[model samples]
Target chain A: MSSCKFINTPALLLDLEIVQRNARLMLDRCQKLGVQLRPHMKTHKTLECADIMTGGSRRCIVVSTLAEASFYADRGYDDILYAYPLPFDKVERCAQLSERLSLFHVLLDNSLALQQLKKRPLSHGKIWHTAGVELTGIYAHCGNTYGCKGEEQIKAVAQQTTAITLQFMEKLKAIGIQGPKSSIGSTPSCSHPVPEMAMLSEVHPGNYVFYDVQQSLIGSCKLEDVAVRVLTRVIGHYPHRNQLLVDCGWTALSLDGGGRLPTGYAIIEGHPELKLTSMTQEHGRVEPISGELDFSQFPLGSVLTFIPHHACATAAMHPVYYVHSKGKIVDTWKPTRGW
Target chain B: MSSCKFINTPALLLDLEIVQRNARLMLDRCQKLGVQLRPHMKTHKTLECADIMTGGSRRCIVVSTLAEASFYADRGYDDILYAYPLPFDKVERCAQLSERLSLFHVLLDNSLALQQLKKRPLSHGKIWHTAGVELTGIYAHCGNTYGCKGEEQIKAVAQQTTAITLQFMEKLKAIGIQGPKSSIGSTPSCSHPVPEMAMLSEVHPGNYVFYDVQQSLIGSCKLEDVAVRVLTRVIGHYPHRNQLLVDCGWTALSLDGGGRLPTGYAIIEGHPELKLTSMTQEHGRVEPISGELDFSQFPLGSVLTFIPHHACATAAMHPVYYVHSKGKIVDTWKPTRGW
Candidate 1:
């Protein structure tokens, strides 16, 4: 049983408690809003986190890729929604999964995509469409909410998205169509749902389970709610350059944020003055945001925790998550990769 | 026997012929220069590429991570040099490899790192240090050459780096030290080596095996020499935004080069007018650089090949590389991941 301190450098450290709390809160939020929470698994595609997000039932999930859908399905988890617009090359795989899973659903996308789905109808009584098209639901990702700065802006975006979604549903009702579910998602909007969101059938928001600095900046979570950190070890001290080289790089921390943060790509957990200025494949250049870097503070082999800017992007870089609680590594979770 | 056309989208497709040509050229260049070519394995960490790179010698390679060192060591590869500065946390693992392999080298780094290596003395007649230190070789990565634009600039930087390395080697000799080797490496510098580079003992260039748009811009190789491309499919067309959505995203292509190229993040192979403007986790937004994006020209599900901006960064995002020749998939190579 290795502890967090003893783990290798450039490892993703998942706080088990923060993850569970984040998971529980989302479940509670959707429960209170009288809507189903079909958590998205794109952020951390590990079975353990999926179980946490789904509250162990492993039911009602959304995946970004068929690889994740198959990974979950192979493990007996069902009721999945392939959330993206239908990809034609993957239609056959989608059909196979649809026939295998209890409720494997894909988006009712453009007419061309509809043809791909119709070419391979479900044989196991899992009917998602009929008469060349089927209206399961309308899905809209409130991705603009990611630009929000605070809770008020987030709620405003959520309210707008929900109202428009409801108006669209009303239009569908006018055309003799009804009972189709509506889903609007983005971690920011879902984390601070508007009151009108209760009218939707389900809410799907990933990244909340592993809230990060981006979610914090978007007002989706407090800084403390971030559950994951890239644990890196200082390898060199360059006093002349006023920089420190750490073991984490784009391969471990990702270049998603574009190093735009005030603290650079990620926020140093305890060092406010330090910024992760840039990275190569396996080396990160850390320097102070203001004054000269005190090289003694970051001795060689000293660990520094990084709260990632985007959890999904950083999580994808790591092959395994070191899940820990109270500084003790409790478990290791492997994630499925590739589509 | 799947072909490139039938394989799944958002895959790394390696051109076997190009790769072989690249390996052969690098080997020939080093042989002509009278220097050992210890190709770095960070670009594509697959054994197949390693075999092609070393000409099946299975020895004298450089890796950025211990996982890579162990991965190669387990497969009977020897003379492994963990090219990174000695990381404190990985010292124990390094020691084990040091005692196990014929030549497992770590950087003779700062005094603190020297102490870490001193803590674990090598046994069984293997020696890296005695009396608190040993000088195996001097290694310098001429990474500054990555910014060079053409052959002249690359040769200039290569000459400068070689001169500085030789000067340092002379300083070591002045201090009564002899029989120490020197190495300076970068794809651009090694691709167009200066005459003085022949004085160095070794050159380790990795990304030359998978040249990319960045390397082409740096003038290391012709764009046609790039051996890998990310195969993506257009999944959606938003004619309103004049954009096409491809299944390739940051997850497949990586957020490297920061969309700095005229073609945004990457150069769409044979589609010079297009730019990969942006990407989410699983979606890439492609739009024309100047004119309207005639949607009919790119039907839904049509494939687009993308030459990555940075091959090492993009390759790190993928789990497997699909090797092909003349449009037929010949083999698949799985690369080791994690630190």
Candidate 2:
């Protein structure tokens, strides 16, 4: 059989060893800090990977979608925080899963979403009311570099949260809903978290898994902390035009521009100046502004390393991670869900 | 049972009826043009969708990767085109698959790719070589918006064809290979193609499937002919700030910046001045120029339409199509491959 046939080009291949090391590193870091680590499963959709990360804790998880919550819940993951704003249309699923699972939390940032959730009339005898209405949380995305840029902007989220909570309460009372949890998280803002503002429950930050290009640019993490890098092959060169093409395209990587990160296809590791500058569907174009390095070293089929813009977003684009220990494949992990 | 669950809030959804209509429309268009239609399967990876698009003909398909090639080929599609540049590392797969399938055409813009394809010694016998190489076609991507522009660039591609052919023969001889086919396509350069220059047998243009922001920018198709659009809901409003956040995000639509197009996000049908201006992971920020129109008319939960930049690229982002028939979902069609 042809080797590497299973590993298709334009497919995301993660280094599992790096991933495991990354996960364990975070777990240990959190253990030292004495903070409850609720690793976001959005970075690795595989149930197996989650088990490894949590060490079979069935511990709390931060999910980007209710579907993720459902997937993990089916796999017996009981405590989960659906960290995105509750889509008003999806409140029923939230209420239903909340009843079945030990704990399921939904987030709402705006009055309209809370109003929609309120529209789901809670029957007095429903099982959902018993397990916990208080478990439902609200997340206010504050100080996102792509949108709100500064500390001044972070304050805007606080102001907005206060206003939103008041309106949220009014709708809850109208629908006769009881106490719910309050929570907030934005990695950029959480570094200087207003814990009092997210006073009701836990904080969920995903990017701390593998800080990337946008994180480094936003000062959320240093360049050294980046754990994930896409291994790509250089295919063509036109020195006179100052360009080279790499095999990693959006399909192999992802299309997330990461809000306000330095805009480029990807950050070239080892060679700082050579960024994956532009791309089409199947090719990445790299342009270096400084001295002309010997691209011939990469030649027509040399592999290069890359740091993605958003680790969570980029991870969602790939199918499997090739777990490597010191650059040789040891194990492979597959994501459980992607659609 | 629970309603169909969308994994993520901002994920792409296909209205099945609209998708069917889209397939029918494209099929009819190609039939009228007297050109054999090969729908780029990259847009929709589902087997069900591919069956409808191919109209029972899976002999020739345009794929973006070997994963897709192998995927469809396993499902009985024999003729395939790995349309992107065939990297040196992948030539063996091409040669191996040629032994099984009737044909597999690969695109090549530079001589380096050909050299790499030649570098691999064929693992198959002479019969495989003659049949496979004869069926294999080369494509020139001399029409990138950033690439050599206008007639001069087009002529450069034509002039380079002689050298390309001579180099191809020399490389084939050097590597003991023969019979590779030559082809050229790039909508910008091949729309009114100079066929005699390169001895091209067939033209492959996937973007001609559904013209979008990029195609429109490049003057390929008019805005009215665009077949696909993302239907999003106005989920939030900072009315005083003149910004409305919609449900479509980089996840639902895509992170394509409309590359060299007049419009950034998808085009808003009736509102010519309105742009889907900015996007985050789950929110599309729409901005209305002062005194032009009040976008609050959309309010919360109102649906709006958007045309993507590159139809094939944007289509790859979503798993299903919202198939509409005169503004209502009549059916749901699931793509064959995806999460």
Show how many residue pairs clash in every candidate, following the order shown: 0, 20
Task: Give per-residue CA lDDT, model 2, range B262-301, as digits (tens).
Answer: 4457777576677777776556888774454475477676
Q: For candidate 1, give the lDDT of residue B248.
A: 93
Best by TM-score: 1
Q: Which tens-of-lDDT digit does each residue in B1-339 have in candidate 1?
A: 247868888999999999999999999999999999999999999999999999999999999999899999999999988888888888789888988998887885588888777777777877663223568789999899987899999999999999999999899889889977898999999999988999999998999999999999999999999999999999999989999999999999998989989999999988999999999999999999998989999999998999999999999998899999887998999999999
DockQ of every candidate = 0.88, 0.31
Native interface contacts kept by each candidate, as a fraction: 0.94, 0.25
Candidate 2 docking: what grade?
acceptable
TM-score of chain A of each: 0.97, 0.74
Error of 2 at A88 (Å): 3.1
Give every prediction's interface RMSD. Answer: 0.9, 4.8
Distance from true position, residue A202, model 1, in Å?
A: 0.6
